[model samples]
Target: MRNRMFAVVALACILVGCGGCSTQGVARQFADELGEVALSAPPTGATYYLQVDNARVIEDAAGDVDMPYCYDLPAWSEDGAETSVVFRTARKLRDGAYLRFDAALLRGMISWEEVGYDELPDAVREVM
Candidate 1:
């Protein structure tokens, strides 16, 4: 009985440890889903945004630049069709301002481009 209980506990522990349901895991899964949708030919288009709300901002693991946190999710058309994959950063900038990005350059296909701060959205500016 003792051996059986130990085995059961060990198995449970292993299963719990193996469960990949952490926030980071969820984010990675989301990124993966976006990648799949991006690869597929969507009719309207797909936008992938990594959002960090409020004062908390996720730093780019590859570099020192802060992530373009946004309140919106990556926009993709419901109907699968060929369209542009636009990447944007809507993050709060220094001095009570926000840095934004444009949809001119299609990104997130092969790599992400570093865009300069454009301007804060009207609503965001108003709030600040």
Candidate 2:
């Protein structure tokens, strides 16, 4: 019984330590998700201001930037259509940069499965 319990506990730890759900780890998370993103590691020292806008990618002077930065589905997006939304950041990030989202501000928005550099859902602004 003890051996079995130890095995389970070890497995759980392994899973949690290896990036389960929370997208916190700066370098590893960015590497898996946005490899083509041109940015440095996310800003470490300064607290950032975040609110959901149409599409805005914030940049830092010390060589960090963040996100494919998408928001606000197009008017034509709908239930069963392929929708692509694009937004441009004011500045570009250097290599190894990353964008971080405001978890608190993004409340009720950003589905777990839908978070990616992919097509936006066609749901209307009200629906989003």
The sequence of per-residue lDDT tens digits that candidate 2 reaches over residues 27-128 is 444433332121221223111111234334433334334443333222122232222222334344332222222111212122122132223333332243
- The number of the candidate with the highest TM-score is 1
Model 1 per-residue lDDT tens digits across residues 77-114: 22322232322344443432232322222123433333
Q: Residue 49 error for model 2, in Å? A: 30
What's the residue-level lDDT of 47 in candidate 1? 32
Query: Count of backbone clashes for each model?
Result: 3, 7
As a whole number from 0 to 100, the lDDT of residue 74 in candidate 2 is 21
Deviation of model 1 at 23, angstroms? 27
Colliding pairs, model 2:
39-96, 39-97, 40-96, 40-97, 41-96, 66-98, 66-99
Point out where model 2 deviates above 4 Å.
20-128
For candidate 1, the per-residue lDDT at 71 reads 27
TM-scores of the models, in the given order?
A: 0.23, 0.21
Best-matching candidate per lDDT:
1
